[model samples]
Target: MGDFSALGEKLKATRNKMGLSLSDMSAKTGVSKTMLSQIERSESMPTIATVWKIANGLKIKLETLLDDSSQLYEVKSIDDKLAIKDDDGRMIIHSIFPFSPISGYEVFYGVFKPGCNYSDDNHTNSTTEQLFVTDGELEMIVGQNTYRITAGCSLSFDSSEKHRYINNGDIDANVLIIVNYE
Candidate 1:
Protein backbone atom coordinates (compact mmCIF):
# COMPACT_ATOMS: atom_id res chain seq x y z
CA MET A 1 0.00 0.00 0.00
CA GLY A 2 2.92 2.31 -0.54
CA ASP A 3 3.19 5.00 -3.16
CA PHE A 4 2.56 3.18 -6.41
CA SER A 5 1.92 5.96 -8.84
CA ALA A 6 5.08 4.99 -10.67
CA LEU A 7 3.79 1.45 -10.84
CA GLY A 8 0.55 2.76 -12.35
CA GLU A 9 2.44 4.54 -15.08
CA LYS A 10 4.48 1.45 -15.77
CA LEU A 11 1.37 -0.67 -15.92
CA LYS A 12 -0.26 1.69 -18.38
CA ALA A 13 2.82 1.53 -20.54
CA THR A 14 2.98 -2.25 -20.39
CA ARG A 15 -0.67 -2.57 -21.25
CA ASN A 16 -0.29 -0.21 -24.17
CA LYS A 17 2.71 -2.17 -25.38
CA MET A 18 0.60 -5.30 -25.21
CA GLY A 19 -2.19 -3.59 -27.18
CA LEU A 20 -4.50 -4.12 -24.26
CA SER A 21 -7.18 -1.91 -22.80
CA LEU A 22 -8.44 -2.15 -19.27
CA SER A 23 -11.18 -4.48 -20.39
CA ASP A 24 -8.69 -6.65 -22.21
CA MET A 25 -6.44 -6.79 -19.19
CA SER A 26 -9.38 -7.62 -17.03
CA ALA A 27 -10.27 -10.52 -19.29
CA LYS A 28 -6.75 -11.83 -19.26
CA THR A 29 -6.02 -11.42 -15.56
CA GLY A 30 -9.49 -12.04 -14.13
CA VAL A 31 -9.28 -8.66 -12.45
CA SER A 32 -12.17 -6.28 -12.74
CA LYS A 33 -11.95 -3.56 -15.35
CA THR A 34 -12.76 -0.90 -12.80
CA MET A 35 -10.02 -2.16 -10.53
CA LEU A 36 -7.62 -2.35 -13.42
CA SER A 37 -8.45 1.23 -14.33
CA GLN A 38 -7.97 2.26 -10.75
CA ILE A 39 -4.59 0.57 -10.77
CA GLU A 40 -3.68 2.27 -14.02
CA ARG A 41 -4.82 5.62 -12.63
CA SER A 42 -2.88 5.22 -9.38
CA GLU A 43 -6.10 5.19 -7.43
CA SER A 44 -5.47 1.71 -6.06
CA MET A 45 -2.63 -0.44 -4.90
CA PRO A 46 -2.80 -4.06 -5.94
CA THR A 47 -2.49 -6.98 -3.57
CA ILE A 48 0.06 -9.76 -3.97
CA ALA A 49 -2.41 -11.92 -5.88
CA THR A 50 -3.27 -9.06 -8.18
CA VAL A 51 0.40 -8.51 -8.87
CA TRP A 52 0.83 -12.17 -9.69
CA LYS A 53 -2.25 -12.19 -11.88
CA ILE A 54 -1.16 -9.19 -13.89
CA ALA A 55 2.38 -10.56 -14.27
CA ASN A 56 1.13 -13.95 -15.29
CA GLY A 57 -1.53 -12.63 -17.62
CA LEU A 58 1.03 -10.42 -19.27
CA LYS A 59 3.73 -13.08 -19.14
CA ILE A 60 6.12 -10.74 -17.38
CA LYS A 61 8.30 -10.99 -14.29
CA LEU A 62 7.03 -9.81 -10.91
CA GLU A 63 9.76 -7.22 -10.70
CA THR A 64 8.74 -5.82 -14.04
CA LEU A 65 6.16 -3.92 -12.04
CA LEU A 66 7.63 -3.95 -8.53
CA ASP A 67 11.27 -2.93 -9.04
CA ASP A 68 11.76 0.65 -7.96
CA SER A 69 15.40 0.84 -6.98
CA SER A 70 18.58 0.46 -8.99
CA GLN A 71 21.34 1.25 -6.51
CA LEU A 72 24.49 -0.77 -7.00
CA TYR A 73 24.93 -1.27 -3.25
CA GLU A 74 21.41 -1.11 -1.95
CA VAL A 75 20.84 -1.76 1.71
CA LYS A 76 17.47 -3.43 1.93
CA SER A 77 15.74 -5.44 4.61
CA ILE A 78 12.47 -7.33 4.98
CA ASP A 79 10.09 -5.00 6.73
CA ASP A 80 6.37 -5.32 7.44
CA LYS A 81 5.79 -1.73 6.46
CA LEU A 82 6.54 -2.79 2.90
CA ALA A 83 4.10 -5.64 2.98
CA ILE A 84 1.27 -6.08 0.48
CA LYS A 85 -1.81 -7.54 2.01
CA ASP A 86 -5.21 -8.92 1.17
CA ASP A 87 -8.26 -7.03 2.36
CA ASP A 88 -8.62 -9.23 5.43
CA GLY A 89 -4.88 -9.29 6.03
CA ARG A 90 -4.91 -13.05 5.89
CA MET A 91 -1.93 -13.06 3.57
CA ILE A 92 0.98 -10.63 3.73
CA ILE A 93 3.97 -10.47 1.39
CA HIS A 94 7.22 -8.60 1.78
CA SER A 95 9.50 -8.57 -1.19
CA ILE A 96 13.07 -8.99 0.03
CA PHE A 97 14.66 -8.96 -3.41
CA PRO A 98 12.87 -8.04 -6.58
CA PHE A 99 14.08 -10.21 -9.42
CA SER A 100 15.83 -8.56 -12.30
CA PRO A 101 16.12 -10.07 -15.74
CA ILE A 102 19.87 -10.12 -15.11
CA SER A 103 19.52 -11.98 -11.81
CA GLY A 104 16.64 -14.28 -12.87
CA TYR A 105 15.54 -14.71 -9.28
CA GLU A 106 13.53 -13.09 -6.49
CA VAL A 107 12.92 -13.57 -2.78
CA PHE A 108 9.90 -12.92 -0.54
CA TYR A 109 9.05 -13.17 3.11
CA GLY A 110 5.41 -14.02 3.71
CA VAL A 111 2.94 -14.44 6.53
CA PHE A 112 -0.18 -16.48 6.01
CA LYS A 113 -3.10 -16.67 8.34
CA PRO A 114 -5.14 -19.83 8.36
CA GLY A 115 -6.88 -20.50 5.01
CA CYS A 116 -4.80 -18.00 3.11
CA ASN A 117 -2.93 -18.81 -0.10
CA TYR A 118 -1.78 -17.75 -3.52
CA SER A 119 -3.98 -18.22 -6.52
CA ASP A 120 -3.37 -21.18 -8.80
CA ASP A 121 -2.09 -18.88 -11.53
CA ASN A 122 0.47 -17.19 -9.32
CA HIS A 123 3.53 -18.19 -11.37
CA THR A 124 4.80 -18.78 -14.85
CA ASN A 125 5.75 -22.07 -16.43
CA SER A 126 9.48 -21.42 -16.46
CA THR A 127 10.31 -21.02 -12.81
CA THR A 128 11.16 -22.93 -9.68
CA GLU A 129 10.12 -22.05 -6.15
CA GLN A 130 11.91 -22.95 -2.95
CA LEU A 131 10.00 -22.26 0.23
CA PHE A 132 11.23 -22.49 3.82
CA VAL A 133 8.80 -22.37 6.67
CA THR A 134 10.16 -20.56 9.72
CA ASP A 135 7.24 -20.40 12.12
CA GLY A 136 4.09 -22.45 11.52
CA GLU A 137 2.80 -25.21 9.28
CA LEU A 138 1.80 -25.01 5.64
CA GLU A 139 0.43 -27.25 2.96
CA MET A 140 2.06 -26.83 -0.39
CA ILE A 141 -0.26 -28.08 -3.07
CA VAL A 142 1.33 -28.85 -6.39
CA GLY A 143 -0.36 -30.64 -9.24
CA GLN A 144 -2.51 -32.84 -7.05
CA ASN A 145 0.28 -33.39 -4.56
CA THR A 146 -0.02 -31.96 -1.08
CA TYR A 147 3.21 -31.59 0.84
CA ARG A 148 3.18 -30.54 4.44
CA ILE A 149 6.12 -28.32 5.32
CA THR A 150 6.69 -27.61 8.99
CA ALA A 151 8.80 -25.01 10.72
CA GLY A 152 12.47 -25.27 9.80
CA CYS A 153 11.60 -27.41 6.80
CA SER A 154 11.82 -26.54 3.13
CA LEU A 155 10.19 -27.52 -0.13
CA SER A 156 11.34 -26.93 -3.67
CA PHE A 157 9.40 -27.56 -6.85
CA ASP A 158 8.74 -26.47 -10.37
CA SER A 159 6.22 -23.62 -10.39
CA SER A 160 4.87 -23.78 -13.90
CA GLU A 161 2.07 -26.20 -13.29
CA LYS A 162 -0.76 -25.89 -10.79
CA HIS A 163 0.50 -24.83 -7.38
CA ARG A 164 -0.40 -22.89 -4.23
CA TYR A 165 0.71 -22.46 -0.61
CA ILE A 166 -1.92 -22.60 2.11
CA ASN A 167 -1.81 -22.34 5.88
CA ASN A 168 -4.47 -24.58 7.26
CA GLY A 169 -3.03 -24.64 10.75
CA ASP A 170 -4.55 -22.74 13.60
CA ILE A 171 -1.50 -20.46 13.88
CA ASP A 172 0.02 -18.08 11.41
CA ALA A 173 2.75 -19.29 9.07
CA ASN A 174 5.94 -17.41 8.33
CA VAL A 175 7.85 -18.36 5.21
CA LEU A 176 10.67 -17.40 2.93
CA ILE A 177 10.11 -18.14 -0.75
CA ILE A 178 12.82 -17.91 -3.34
CA VAL A 179 11.75 -18.02 -6.97
CA ASN A 180 14.14 -18.69 -9.81
CA TYR A 181 12.88 -17.89 -13.28
CA GLU A 182 14.22 -19.56 -16.35
Candidate 2:
Protein backbone atom coordinates (compact mmCIF):
# COMPACT_ATOMS: atom_id res chain seq x y z
CA MET A 1 0.00 0.00 0.00
CA GLY A 2 2.89 2.30 0.62
CA ASP A 3 4.30 2.09 -2.89
CA PHE A 4 1.73 3.64 -5.15
CA SER A 5 3.90 4.26 -8.18
CA ALA A 6 4.19 0.62 -9.24
CA LEU A 7 0.50 -0.01 -8.88
CA GLY A 8 -0.27 3.19 -10.72
CA GLU A 9 1.92 2.17 -13.62
CA LYS A 10 0.38 -1.28 -13.85
CA LEU A 11 -3.13 0.06 -13.67
CA LYS A 12 -2.52 2.63 -16.36
CA ALA A 13 -0.85 0.13 -18.64
CA THR A 14 -3.62 -2.41 -18.23
CA ARG A 15 -6.31 0.16 -18.85
CA ASN A 16 -4.61 1.49 -21.95
CA LYS A 17 -4.08 -1.97 -23.35
CA MET A 18 -7.80 -2.59 -23.03
CA GLY A 19 -8.57 0.69 -24.80
CA LEU A 20 -10.57 2.01 -21.91
CA SER A 21 -10.64 5.63 -20.89
CA LEU A 22 -10.96 6.83 -17.35
CA SER A 23 -14.72 7.24 -17.67
CA ASP A 24 -15.13 3.83 -19.25
CA MET A 25 -13.01 2.23 -16.56
CA SER A 26 -14.95 4.05 -13.90
CA ALA A 27 -18.21 2.74 -15.23
CA LYS A 28 -16.86 -0.76 -15.61
CA THR A 29 -15.21 -0.82 -12.20
CA GLY A 30 -17.87 1.27 -10.41
CA VAL A 31 -15.11 3.65 -9.41
CA SER A 32 -15.24 7.35 -10.04
CA LYS A 33 -13.19 8.80 -12.80
CA THR A 34 -11.54 11.18 -10.35
CA MET A 35 -10.51 8.28 -8.16
CA LEU A 36 -9.18 6.39 -11.17
CA SER A 37 -7.20 9.41 -12.23
CA GLN A 38 -5.73 9.75 -8.78
CA ILE A 39 -4.74 6.11 -8.79
CA GLU A 40 -3.13 6.43 -12.22
CA ARG A 41 -1.19 9.46 -11.07
CA SER A 42 -0.01 7.71 -7.91
CA GLU A 43 -1.74 10.31 -5.83
CA SER A 44 -3.99 7.84 -4.08
CA MET A 45 -3.76 4.28 -2.83
CA PRO A 46 -6.52 1.93 -3.75
CA THR A 47 -7.90 -0.26 -1.01
CA ILE A 48 -8.03 -4.03 -1.37
CA ALA A 49 -11.72 -3.91 -2.24
CA THR A 50 -11.11 -1.28 -4.88
CA VAL A 51 -8.32 -3.33 -6.41
CA TRP A 52 -10.61 -6.35 -6.46
CA LYS A 53 -13.24 -4.38 -8.29
CA ILE A 54 -10.72 -3.26 -10.86
CA ALA A 55 -9.47 -6.81 -11.34
CA ASN A 56 -12.99 -8.11 -11.80
CA GLY A 57 -13.72 -5.41 -14.31
CA LEU A 58 -10.50 -6.09 -16.15
CA LYS A 59 -11.00 -9.84 -16.01
CA ILE A 60 -7.60 -10.28 -14.40
CA LYS A 61 -6.27 -12.02 -11.30
CA LEU A 62 -5.89 -10.11 -8.04
CA GLU A 63 -2.23 -10.99 -7.49
CA THR A 64 -1.40 -10.23 -11.08
CA LEU A 65 -2.51 -6.70 -10.53
CA LEU A 66 -1.07 -6.41 -7.02
CA ASP A 67 2.34 -7.81 -7.88
CA ASP A 68 4.93 -5.05 -7.95
CA SER A 69 7.60 -7.05 -9.70
CA SER A 70 7.54 -9.21 -12.81
CA GLN A 71 11.26 -9.44 -13.29
CA LEU A 72 13.05 -12.52 -14.52
CA TYR A 73 15.47 -12.63 -11.60
CA GLU A 74 15.37 -11.13 -8.15
CA VAL A 75 16.09 -11.80 -4.51
CA LYS A 76 13.96 -11.14 -1.47
CA SER A 77 14.44 -11.44 2.27
CA ILE A 78 11.76 -11.77 4.88
CA ASP A 79 11.87 -10.08 8.24
CA ASP A 80 9.83 -11.11 11.25
CA LYS A 81 8.05 -7.79 11.41
CA LEU A 82 6.76 -8.19 7.86
CA ALA A 83 4.75 -11.30 8.68
CA ILE A 84 1.02 -11.66 8.56
CA LYS A 85 -0.24 -12.57 12.04
CA ASP A 86 -3.29 -14.39 13.24
CA ASP A 87 -4.67 -15.83 16.46
CA ASP A 88 -3.51 -12.83 18.45
CA GLY A 89 -0.02 -13.04 16.92
CA ARG A 90 0.51 -16.67 17.94
CA MET A 91 0.80 -17.62 14.27
CA ILE A 92 2.81 -15.71 11.70
CA ILE A 93 3.07 -16.11 7.94
CA HIS A 94 5.80 -14.53 5.85
CA SER A 95 5.25 -14.37 2.14
CA ILE A 96 8.35 -15.47 0.30
CA PHE A 97 6.70 -14.90 -3.06
CA PRO A 98 3.17 -13.90 -3.85
CA PHE A 99 0.98 -15.78 -6.30
CA SER A 100 1.98 -15.60 -9.94
CA PRO A 101 0.42 -17.50 -12.77
CA ILE A 102 3.83 -17.80 -14.38
CA SER A 103 5.10 -19.67 -11.33
CA GLY A 104 1.80 -21.50 -10.76
CA TYR A 105 2.10 -21.06 -7.02
CA GLU A 106 2.79 -18.82 -4.05
CA VAL A 107 5.26 -19.51 -1.26
CA PHE A 108 5.05 -18.71 2.44
CA TYR A 109 7.01 -19.50 5.56
CA GLY A 110 5.02 -19.89 8.73
CA VAL A 111 5.74 -20.13 12.42
CA PHE A 112 3.35 -21.28 15.07
CA LYS A 113 4.10 -20.99 18.73
CA PRO A 114 3.25 -23.74 21.18
CA GLY A 115 -0.48 -23.95 21.81
CA CYS A 116 -1.09 -21.83 18.73
CA ASN A 117 -4.31 -22.48 16.89
CA TYR A 118 -5.15 -20.79 13.61
CA SER A 119 -8.28 -21.20 11.54
CA ASP A 120 -8.47 -20.11 7.91
CA ASP A 121 -11.32 -19.90 5.46
CA ASN A 122 -11.58 -21.85 2.25
CA HIS A 123 -9.74 -20.69 -0.86
CA THR A 124 -10.70 -20.97 -4.52
CA ASN A 125 -12.05 -24.34 -5.62
CA SER A 126 -9.02 -25.08 -7.80
CA THR A 127 -6.48 -24.22 -5.12
CA THR A 128 -4.28 -26.74 -3.30
CA GLU A 129 -2.08 -26.15 -0.25
CA GLN A 130 1.12 -28.06 0.52
CA LEU A 131 2.85 -27.79 3.87
CA PHE A 132 6.19 -29.16 5.03
CA VAL A 133 7.02 -29.09 8.67
CA THR A 134 10.56 -27.88 9.09
CA ASP A 135 10.65 -28.02 12.87
CA GLY A 136 8.47 -29.43 15.64
CA GLU A 137 5.00 -30.82 14.93
CA LEU A 138 1.51 -29.61 14.19
CA GLU A 139 -1.96 -30.97 13.54
CA MET A 140 -3.72 -29.88 10.37
CA ILE A 141 -7.47 -30.19 10.29
CA VAL A 142 -8.62 -29.89 6.71
CA GLY A 143 -12.38 -29.95 6.65
CA GLN A 144 -13.49 -33.19 8.32
CA ASN A 145 -10.10 -34.88 8.00
CA THR A 146 -7.26 -34.31 10.45
CA TYR A 147 -3.60 -35.26 10.06
CA ARG A 148 -0.58 -35.07 12.33
CA ILE A 149 2.56 -33.83 10.64
CA THR A 150 5.95 -33.98 12.31
CA ALA A 151 9.24 -32.36 11.43
CA GLY A 152 10.59 -33.42 8.03
CA CYS A 153 7.11 -34.48 6.91
CA SER A 154 4.81 -32.92 4.37
CA LEU A 155 1.12 -32.85 3.56
CA SER A 156 -0.98 -31.73 0.64
CA PHE A 157 -4.71 -31.19 0.44
CA ASP A 158 -7.37 -29.39 -1.49
CA SER A 159 -7.71 -25.95 0.04
CA SER A 160 -11.30 -25.27 -0.95
CA GLU A 161 -12.53 -26.23 2.50
CA LYS A 162 -11.99 -24.67 5.87
CA HIS A 163 -8.71 -25.61 7.53
CA ARG A 164 -7.10 -25.16 10.92
CA TYR A 165 -3.59 -25.57 12.28
CA ILE A 166 -2.61 -26.33 15.85
CA ASN A 167 0.85 -26.72 17.29
CA ASN A 168 0.85 -29.04 20.27
CA GLY A 169 4.62 -29.07 20.61
CA ASP A 170 6.31 -27.18 23.42
CA ILE A 171 8.67 -25.55 20.92
CA ASP A 172 7.91 -23.39 17.94
CA ALA A 173 6.66 -25.13 14.83
CA ASN A 174 8.06 -23.96 11.51
CA VAL A 175 6.47 -24.87 8.19
CA LEU A 176 7.07 -24.04 4.57
CA ILE A 177 3.84 -23.78 2.62
CA ILE A 178 3.16 -23.55 -1.07
CA VAL A 179 -0.25 -22.72 -2.45
CA ASN A 180 -1.01 -23.79 -5.98
CA TYR A 181 -3.69 -21.81 -7.74
CA GLU A 182 -3.89 -24.10 -10.72
Off by over 4 Å in 2: 1-73
Question: Per-residue lDDT tens digits of candidate 1, residues 1-182?
Answer: 45565788888878886678788889988889998889889998999889889888876887777767453376665653488897378889888887644456888898989978765556753588899999999998899889999999999988887887788899999999998886
Candidate 1 Cα errors over 4 Å, as ranges: 1-74
lDDT of 2 by residue, 27-62 (tens): 898988998899989898989899999888766787
Residue 116, candidate 1: Cα error in Å is 1.6
The 0-to-1 C-alpha lDDT of every candidate, in the order given, reads 0.82, 0.84
Residue 69, model 2, lDDT: 82
The prediction achieving the highest lDDT against the true structure is 2
Alpha-carbon shift of residue 121 in model 1 (angstroms)? 1.6
Please provide TM-scores, in order, for all candidate models, with all chains considered together. Answer: 0.56, 0.60
Model 1 clash pairs? none
